[model samples]
Target: MHGKTLTFLLLLISIACLDLLLTHCGRSDHKQKLQKQDTVLLTKHWESPIPHQEIPEGLTSISAASCGTCHAEIYKEWQQSTHAVAFQDPQFQAELKKDNIITCLNCHTPLQNQQEFIVRGFINGDYKTPWKEVNPHFDKSLQLESITCATCHVRDGQVIGALGSDRAPHKTLKDPGFLSEKLCLGCHNVVDEASPQLVCTFETGDEWNANWAKREGKNCISCHMPSTERPLFPGMSKRAGHFHHFPASGIPKFKDREAGRLESMEFTESPVHPGYSPGDLLNYQLKIKNSFAGHNVPTGDPERFFLIRYQWMDASGNILKEEVHRIGEEWQWHPVAKKISDNNLKPKEERVYPFTQLLDRAGTYRFRVEVTKHRMTEENARYNQILGEYPLSIEVYSKQYEIAVE
Candidate 1:
């Protein structure tokens, strides 16, 4: 009788375990279904149409301006970044001289009709003259600010925010780190695999998403769009909890030349008087490497500048001659008070250029190049002082040149 009871009890316990397993499986399926429904709903909303608008005259495209319609403050701040000026940068224009295509505009500059933007030379194309209607240009609107809202937050074709998110915007964080940091990698970690040749030399997002940067706990927005004080606006009662500036790598030479950051420098020599007599031709080479940087070298606004000063001097320490080799030119956003250029060599990159000039007078001469770092703002200028001068560096490159009197 006891044995019979033990068998009956075992059967009852087994049945209970089976019932529990079935319940757990059912809940798992329900959760997955909810997730799928959420994804589908998001897609439907993001794909919803905005009234078609005409492409601005001579302009190839125009984004929906969805974020601009709501978050005017963020839209304005976004305009201040280099991402906004991705296309209009003169350096970018110089690059276009190498490879011109519409594919680049599609990613670099957001527009409604990329073809039109290219045709207008508002992007990369055969733009011989300044664009008449530069709306598609970064200087004109805040719409093209580095991919903006429509690119990522509305993933799976779903709006993710109160403004442009495809779904009914969820104000509260359902996922603990969702709004704080996690969702950033979904887009910022992107790379242009379609044309690896034209790939951005400095892919900060790519670097930040890597295991190294991840281990450091550096989130995307922390470095890309850093926080700055701003007046709180409506519709952002929740988002305002964490300021979203999306600080980027690279910055212009700060206004205070002494405050510039020094990474590295280089030098080279070219035929100064290849076939000419002593008073005929003076030639040499100038190279300054962006050996290092606190962030990416060309950080912040697209118009940042880096330049080098070349001087030819006599033994008496008197200035015999001098020329400036601009690594980069004065950008439009911050026009140079003087003619200045930048090498724009990213970290670990090197550039070489030959300098030639006819010598009017011959003397015991020496060549000297000083690297000056300039920033757009005074409080921010450090490219020169931080990198070159602060410690009174004696490692500068110098060479002696002579114009042999015939």
Candidate 2:
């Protein structure tokens, strides 16, 4: 009778476990189904038609080149910008091929809303998968013109701007967002759901908001799209308006701006001496300051880095000691580390490094400090197979000081 009781208890326990397992599986399946439904709903909303409007005649199809015909000066500035070659950039092309980054293309070569024909993906709610259809009127030959004139300024057969007048060949519409950070957040504030720990792949817009720039009423355009007095159209009146270059760190026209100005480098001897000669046991403090840049230096692209290399050499130029201090955030993906170390400089921030060196001989020595901007770390470059294939250290700033010892 006791043996039968034990068997009956075992059977009851097995049945309970089976029931729990089935319940858990059923909930999981339901959750997945709901997620799918949400995605479908969002995608449908993205494809929905905008309010109908009669497009102006003779303005059916317009391209950046076509705009350039009237706005020649603005066109020249934009031609040299990173936005001009957004889609055809070699680095972008290589990265796309290496990582198979299909999602990035939407931001690089964006589509337009079919009804209003405005650029999509500007607001937070506008973010959707299977991006809106490519602009039907887009020129095939100008496909490489990544953020073209129409990307931000054209909508529904009308030219949009911060302020518009009835002076152009086509209708004009005023958009306040164009004058603020709202226009830049869509692409600049990217969140990678796959990287739960490092969800923000790029946070320039967020950084701007957090910094004093927002308090001072300064926006991304304050520094990036500086205004100049230029003619908007051929034989038109010159007016103070923003340039189209939109210069940022990496582009050639703004390369020097990336590193910011190295304000000052000072070396001070240590107060305490170890009885040995100054040359025998060297101790000093090195401080470097960044005078420019509204945001953090080397702000975008986690792969980009700034390296500070210091070398102690004898009068004969023979290296006695060398050390390298790497600034900027360093991350690893294989082991899934969000950030290994971040020593990057903030705008107008100063960083100091203390050094102690033990030398074998005593003589006149020279301390050389070289700051270089690298597109990516050696490890990242090797992983991407782009090491030495592209521009590695395009901008380098250096300083050297000679020290005498008894």
Candidate 3:
């Protein structure tokens, strides 16, 4: 009887060792392939949620309300943020209907319990090899929370972040890495497998790395997560903390800011050129600078753009002449997805527009400049069928010159 029991125990130990060996070998092989930049294989890797065996103790419910128990202020801010409704955005929903929509959920609603598929491999890529199955552990309620706090703060069944509280309701651990730009790359960095020139997804992180990182020591946290002097928790005393209402292109005012600023607008020869009279030339230079933004003025979604409108208006505010300039990346959307041109303002770069027109009449008029931020192109807007779902454009800068037409 003792020999039979020993044999069974040895057999169990052998299986456990074999499983660990296989898992380690698989991970090593995966790393090697990624170094080769096999995009299809990489796409196969990201088509699933972050792996974890169980929900964190304090986040089992996967509700923002649960975090609100101690983080009331932070929770309110998250409610107003784009991340809170990422999975539920109507435009995104419509766009995802045509293809393998489940792949998108890995980022939009990125929690193990939020997905219905336990993807083993692609039905078609490197990540889709073995096969997929229904996830018996899926929780429908968790799926609706979208990119909730747990998406970043919960991992391996613990509450993790740049700072963690021991007095809180859950097990906490401090991970300084949570504050790094790499954390944002979990979703923000994406390159196209088909067209490498035009990364078809948000390459905000990559842009920051290439254009802004080396020049400036700031990262996404410096902008998106500004410091607040709110208590880490009640009774902890006021101190610097982070929240979710990112001052990026998420809100109307932020859109105006990140889109760039109209530094100044003046005539080339101010004072209207000495002895300027009718039949003479009227000239001026309108200046625009990407003052504060770290990346291109209108980065992120390719659809985002800026419109600069230069106008000559009569005293009655009736426009007599207008010239519009577009600043954004243009793309060939059909036949093949490719970028045609990109004239977005670069970091600290200033563009000057010189205007000259014959002064044909002697009258009082106004030379005006208006800069507006457009969220997307009209064609794409109509296709998504979300023309009026929200404010599509916001006026960023407007200046009028009370001028006398010589």
Report, for every candidate in turn, its global Cα lDDT versus the true structure. Answer: 0.42, 0.60, 0.67
The predicted structure with the larger TM-score, 1 or 3, is 3
Q: For each candidate, what TM-score against the reference?
A: 0.37, 0.71, 0.78
lDDT, candidate 3, at 163 = 60
Q: What TM-score would you give candidate 2 relative to the actual structure?
A: 0.71
Error of 1 at 232 (Å): 5.4
Error of 2 at 70 (Å): 1.8
lDDT of 2 by residue, 1-406 (tens): 4674465455445534655775777765755453344333334222333222334444554567777887888888788777777776556777665543334555666543222133322212323222233355544554567777776776676677775666776777888776467767777776563222223367777766776667777777877777787678867788878877676555242333232223222333335332345447666665666544556767767877777787988888899889888778877665464767776677567787676777556567787767777766667667666565555665456667676665
Candidate with top TM-score is 3
- Cα misplacement distance, residue 185 of candidate 3 (Å): 1.8
lDDT of 3 by residue, 250-306 (tens): 433222222222321222223443344678777777677776666776877788888
Residue clash pairs of candidate 2: none
Residue 183 displacement in candidate 1 (angstroms): 7.9
Tens-digit lDDT track of model 1 for 39-113 = 222121111222123433322333435455555676655555445555654444545554443344444544332
Ranking of predictions according to TM-score: 3, 2, 1
CA lDDT of 47 in candidate 1?
Answer: 19
